[model samples]
Target: MMRAELAQNFRQLELKKKLEPMLPVLDFIAWSLLKHNQDVVSQLWVLSKQQSWRTSKSIPNSLWNWICSAVDEVTLDPMTKHAWLLLSDD
Candidate 1:
């Protein structure tokens, strides 16, 4: 159910051209992590380290707010707390 929802969200972002080319890959990583496919998730993380893009300002500010809200949600998850911590440390 969660994977489907995430995939739907990804599809919308892709259609809007609001996501990077690596986003589908990132979506896979997120879905895999949530599904306990750590090996695949780790591999995606490593691959992401090699990618770069020009950050754009045209993205809606509401999207940034939504990201913050999502991060807040993730922070409440025990399994995802580490990711939140790493984000905070940065």
Candidate 2:
């Protein structure tokens, strides 16, 4: 059990290392989507409407819902929340 847990942790660490290099590109994509695509925000909202934390089916599902809920529960606006999602590695 300990070995399995260690392997899992290592795998997650490796994945993060691989993805870290893409941060800049990801930021650019988010920025472009927000700036050039007026429909992106609505699309995100529409997608969220169809999506729920309870019914999420992905591995580590409900990530976005968790984020949005946390944001909504706080003082941030929609734009800032969206920006937070784009900037956060999680």
The model with the greatest lDDT is 2
Top candidate (TM-score): 2
Would you list the C-alpha lDDT of every candidate in the order shown? 0.53, 0.55
Cα RMSD for candidates in order? 16.5, 15.5
For model 1, the local distance difference test gives 0.53
- How high is each candidate's TM-score? 0.23, 0.39
TM-score of 2: 0.39
Candidate 2, residues 1-90: lDDT per residue as tens digits? 799999999999999989866654654465455754545754674476478453324322233443354344335455557644544333
Q: Any runs in candidate 2 off by more than 4 Å, and if so which?
A: 36-90
**Residue 43 deviation, candidate 1, in Å?**
2.8
Task: Give the distance in Å from residue 53's predicted Cα in candidate 1 to where it truly belongs.
Answer: 3.0
lDDT of 1 by residue, 1-90 (tens): 699999999899787675555555555556545546545644554465446454433433433343355444333444656654544332
Residue 78 C-alpha lDDT in model 1:
48
